[model samples]
Target: MTSADGKGPVVVKEGSDALLPCSLSTEENIEGKLFHWKKDGQKEVFLYDAGVHYNNGRPGQDEQFKGRVSHFQDGLKHRNASITIRNTKLADRGNYTCDFPRLQNQTFHIELDVGAAAEPSVTILDQIKDWALLQCLVRGASPMPKVEWKDSSGNMVPAHEPQVSQRGDGTYDVTLQAAVNKTDRFRCVVTQEEIYHQIYAETNVLLPPPPEND
Candidate 1:
């Protein structure tokens, strides 16, 4: 593949679609040609032979990618063979190859990096006389998010060091706890800067009033 398109990994947020680009460097139309796309050089992501495709009931697509991969049919005449993966998952992150086995065995490579899944749930764990203990937890997120607690006014609230663990599926689970001295609407903000994605969940903490004076 030509270096005209600088080599950089395609960044996509988890659960969103990702476009892996590939095309004929010679700008030769490939509408009636055959090309193959594979993941990590193993999984059959998609394949197009002549006018038929794996998505068009051609079959033979890897089970993990079935019904989730698509190609740009209109771009075929422009030498484009790019494919898009819908509802991306962390397991889908890997190196991909676009191959034209018939034409001098021409091949191109692309890297895909699926970002973290955003969705942190906040809940009240415990409440004392004047303070309430709140917990925020994020599960099944990749590349571990920067979890934090903030008040309704957006000021950061002090919290215990986040407890992080990895799941069997290679995703992460993070838990953070904070003690708020006053009743307020608190939020747990989850940020994955690499993908420029941020999400948050909030909860209201209402501490009972102090005991009445004698």
Candidate 2:
């Protein structure tokens, strides 16, 4: 069993698909070698020899992995045994191991983090008697996050002045302002893609008077 090279941690979002790639450096024929992929510390999910089968030599696979996993025979010829996981879930977070019978085994660790779809937070930038400026900050995301504002009635509330800033840490900072009296319930929704997964984070911004004004 030969280990894969340059394998590192992979982050994925919820409800998405991801591929765990692995390759061997050996020149031996992989067809005769028994192949197995399992979630480390979990049950074997996939195995193959001259044909695809499970650990028990059954014709079918574990129901939990039905329609969610697959591998390529040609890929294995090149010492590649990458597996695809469709509709990734938060529960799928963990290390995965690929082993070859009478050979070496390779391990790949995966970390999956689920982002919140609704996170409501507020930061008062400035406040006046009739008007105020507030900042709604949404953090920890991949790809690009979409931020939208909504009023209490669930109506789309256009930002009086919309401003967006990218943080050094790869997250986003979105700021929007509204009239103090017009404030009711403003919701901030953040959406992004982590790896091949879709994740989101959101926060609600409320406009209340400062302690001095209260």
Which candidate number has the best lDDT?
1
Alpha-carbon TM-score of each model against the true structure: 0.84, 0.54
> Against the hidden true structure, what lDDT does model 1 obtain?
0.88
In model 2, the clashing pairs are 1-103, 1-104, 119-202, 119-203, 120-203, 120-204, 121-204
Clash count, one per candidate: 0, 7
Candidate 2 off by > 4 Å: 1-7, 54-60, 104-128, 131-214
Q: What is the C-alpha lDDT profile of model 1 across 56-137, one tens digit per residue? A: 7797899999999999999999999998899998889888899999999998888888977668998899887899999999
Candidate number of the best TM-score: 1
Cand. 2 TM to true fold: 0.54
Give the per-residue lDDT of model 2 (tens digit) for 7-115.
Answer: 4555565566767766567744565566677775465667777664653345556576766777767776777766778887655665667666556454444433333
Off by over 4 Å in 1: 1-4, 56-59, 208-214
lDDT (0 to 1) per candidate: 0.88, 0.57
Note each model's CA RMSD in angstroms: 3.2, 9.5
